[model samples]
Target: MSYLQKPSYYTISLVVVLLLPFTILFASFLLPFSAYLRGPPPIAAGSVVAGGCSHGAADGGGGGGGGGGVRPEISILVGVHTMAKKHSRRHLVRMAYAVQQTAALRGAARVDVRFALCARPMPPEHRAFVALEARAYGDVMLIDCDESPDKGKTGSSAEDVTTGTWLNMGNKAKNRVNIFPRMYDFKGVKPEDFLEDTIGVHQLKQDLRWAQTLEHFNVTWLDPSSKMTNSLLS
Candidate 1:
């Protein structure tokens, strides 16, 4: 018998043309199905996120036997009643409070120190300086009053009300006052009256006295590499 006849060129071309569309279709379906079998891509490392428990659960002692319970936060607002003319004093006072804001203390207590001023008449330069200071510090309040301390500028509770409105202290938490804990350098206060646990030292009208007070309280001196330094003491 003779060898099988070789396929003709026209027959081979016809076979390729008929199978072209089916091959393309099969490849399209197979590509996506293969990807599906491989499963969804992983989330980016930076895109991952987590959440914490609610304040109610945190404060109510959280779930049983969880030693990593959240610490209850204490919010304190220390309003320093000062005149608009005291710009340098304000800077010093800001440093005095800012330096004391240790990380450990900040983790537990949210202490907001604000300077309260009166809407009294002042020079244009003074007003501009006050505006600049307020913008820079974001902790100054101008109360609607124009009178000296003797004329009852601070004797009324208007400042307190204004402060409450400014701070949005309308929450349900019951407020308590502790004016005694703060150090007031009035004539009645003596050296022996200084307490190690005093919250603050008021009436520090003199820079030398302020430096001394801060030095006394910051007995545990700040770290050598610390950026926060008491310029007054320096």
Candidate 2:
């Protein structure tokens, strides 16, 4: 035990063995306390995304992350009723909406465009593709019904069943205005028909037709540092 003598291997091993458990215990207590001081991670912007196709909402995850900010003044949800087979058109429609999310629009209102699909009769391949697509876009809803436009299986407003009918009740009519020929276009969408004012274009089911229509409004991504290319339709 001379002060100048080098410690033996046995002595060194004994010292380390005695200190190891204490070191581990200190870390175990300190790690959680440090994490607690940091607080829970901030919830991502657009984390609560997607509306269900059925009457109820379907919970899922995966979306872009950003810091929180003041809620937009207005919130609008445009639900497009579609079949599961139209995958390409869905992508085009998503791109169309995404590009239109300009700085001005983001500041004033939050517009979410989600697709509704009938889930009952979906084919195996369609189901798999729809699941992946919903996960990727976070905007698809699967309706539990047969895929039929005439069956009225899509959905209905609960107010419709109330004793008071809106149509004939004069002043009791629902607080809504017709958007046709103004905010929405029900007519078949053409390439030249894509206008800056219209909020929606309907009946563009054909892939080529939809692509052409989107090409009219597709804004070219020009940032040199970014890898995104111009519209594929071009």
Candidate 3:
């Protein structure tokens, strides 16, 4: 008998070798399954990707980038009378051109230009003036007051002066008294029988102010006697 026999080195080495393969296999299987058993994967990485997407959108990238474009800032309405004096007609046409050029310079995407004309018997020169003005400005609208029920009204006063009268008047006045007859009305419509009350200087000013209030444009009235100044349009 003698001291207790020590474990053999060979036996210990054999045991380690046998366990190595099982340990590797167990580790391989446990890794993926363990993650599943622990519930969903961590959100930090996914959150980072989502955060990047949101940041791009806010920076005007991705599908939302188109919103970065600028919109039009102004619109113009020019009231022209076909029966106006030769000088007056020419002045209005020149004013319309100036307005269009100014709008282009100001980076406006649109100009809602309208011409109000008396439909009674327009002179040939006046018709020619309208054609030239229309060619200069892409958007042209004509209103023929003769066909309008509101025609022949004294002093630009609405036939019905109630709270919603202006709206009704605007609706009914649609191009009935428009300036460009050829552009707006294909079928020659005549102005209503109503007579327009003559407007005075003070009345004209008041009407202009009222019109300015209704439009989004920066109103610039060009008088026939005034010299044409590009700076004023700017």
Candidate 4:
């Protein structure tokens, strides 16, 4: 250790050799317990929500990265009756403010937005468009229902869907809400609005009666009394 006895290569090598095995052993031991000290934080509700992804496995993949193997918690059956090749109602539903809210709920909750529409006999051009939308968005359930369209306000068409298909759609998710479109601006229906929240949307019931004129139509009361207090009425 004297100043005159400056350290040489051998001395350095000797020290490193003595510490190498202990260093390796220490790292090996620390590896197993490190995860315990730096473990993941406790699970928080909605942190791992299904999340309404504009792309629900759009890559043709099955599930999300973190939400692997998790099925949709809520199923939304939205009926889309195509009035014609260019149905304004269908387009409006896609871009509605309520639709945005529904997407938010989907992302935060296990809710799935599905549209029940008649795909068959759709104009070839419209059919292509339907396919494009279906491919892009993991929503919309199109079926082949035998029905006719309307002309200058004359005709009728039942939803083009089989009971089995409808039932299968219902069975996909744990809980579900069947939303009647044409009554709402958009598929922006939420489980909360009708099931629990009961504040925003004014849901209609089949309690009212309807008649078959030139075309079949829905007639229902302004729920919770026909006062029109709900925002939907406004």
Candidate 5:
């Protein structure tokens, strides 16, 4: 009777082997269920509202009662220095084309991208290129130092090349103080509230520092390199 009552070690081991897989499977299913039940109720309101807002704009219906409608307009200003010459013009034109194409692909009703050329005597070649490009896209404008009313007469002393003078002229022109900034206007559109120094390479560090000042004024500094467009799109 004692021998019969003694459970065989092999039998006990076999019983455990049969139950172990089931135990693990049960735990795998139950643990997640326990976590789901114990954790905070699904963040319903926050996630729901956020999702609604995101789709609302895409569906043309925002909280403002409009459904599946167009998004607000975005103004992009591409500022180029005269030293860039033909290269700058080509780069800017390509950028404008890309911007327009991107906007169209994104389903924007309108995307206004403009190039603001800042330099002295406005290169004749640049002006011609801009004119030709503008006819096709109407996204380029030439802003020359001579256009600034504050620019002194040609006969004056050797011409000031200081950054301060260059920036001062820009501020004045943008503010419509010395001259009316009419280089680019679309449907009575004012210039972009933000400004970017599209100068890179030549004076890399100095250009960056000058751009920093513009940033202080809440302007964005776009890299002058053509690669920037690709980076931005990516």
Candidate 6:
């Protein structure tokens, strides 16, 4: 135990010799797995699609750890026909894991997930309850569809059932989502009639508007150093 005792070297060498076999055994397994894991640098997520748009370079994750970057003015709207005293699936979407891909795919700096429920004839109590949740979560966007059919049971028009909505983009960019309402070109699908198709002309129009408005705002990465490229499209 002296300051420069050489006997300690003997002990250290012996320890190294004892551990060598185990180290070699671990490496024998680790190297092969590592090479398999490193076989190919994954294709960057920039080449992936978002909202069916063939993307080159989105401002977010660029596709690996972060995925495509974020769209500044990203608005996700889910319309519910009924609001209950208890929390509904809509609330689950806002509060939990729903609509994750919309934000993840774009790699946006800011995200606004909201609900567009009609404001007419909703029981005062229900409105108040929803208002409380909105104030708490800041995730409710009310719509005055004002159509209450059959004793105001199913309020709101067919058009308002679940309309595509938009989130105002804060900045400007050409690469903003610009893929919608193409009557002539429907994502390579030449529908005989876009208006009568499963994706109605109205929906297509809304999609076009959503894409246009979202594109107007500039999308930025909340974190600059992240390397996550591919985003989940769920």
Tell me the TM-score of each prediction against the true structure.
Answer: 0.51, 0.54, 0.29, 0.34, 0.27, 0.29
What is the number of backbone collisions in each predicted candidate, taken in the order shown?
A: 0, 0, 23, 4, 7, 20
Q: Encode model 6's per-residue lDDT on 192-227: one tens digit a residue.
A: 333342211223234354343222322222244444
Instruction: Write model 2 residue lDDT over 53-160, tens digit each, in one string.
Output: 221222112111211456677766666767789887677766666666655666677666678788878889988899887756677877677876556444345533
Which numbered prediction scores highest in TM-score against the true structure? 2
Best by lDDT: 2
The lDDT of each candidate is 0.61, 0.62, 0.41, 0.44, 0.43, 0.44
Candidate 3 vs candidate 4: the lDDT winner is 4
Local distance difference test, candidate 6: 0.44
Model 3 bad stretches (over 4 Å): 1-69, 73-111, 138-140, 144-234
lDDT of 3 by residue, 1-234 (tens): 545777689988999999999999999999999898889665542121212223222212111111234645543343333332243434444453444354244355333333444444556886676555444433223444553335542234543364246557667544334333222211111233111331111122243443432232333555655557555655
Per-residue alpha-carbon lDDT of candidate 5 for residues 1-234, written as tens digits (9 for 90 to 100): 677697989999999999999999999999999988898565433222221223223122111122235644542333333332554444433443342243344453333334444446556886566555444444344444464435433223334345447668677535323222422122211235323332221222243443443344334546657788668868
Assess candidate 4 and give its TM-score to the true structure. 0.34
Error of 1 at 52 (Å): 31
Clashing pairs in 1: none
Best of the two (1, 6) by TM-score: 1
Q: Comparing candidate 2 with candidate 3, which one achieves the higher lDDT?
A: 2
Candidate 2: which pairs clash?
Answer: none
lDDT computed for candidate 5: 0.43
Residue-level lDDT tens digits of model 1 in 1-234: 545888889999999999999999999999998998899676542221111223222212211111233543676666677787888887776666665655566566656556777778777887888777655555666777874765444655566566566456565335656577564553323456677668656567777767677666664477766666555357
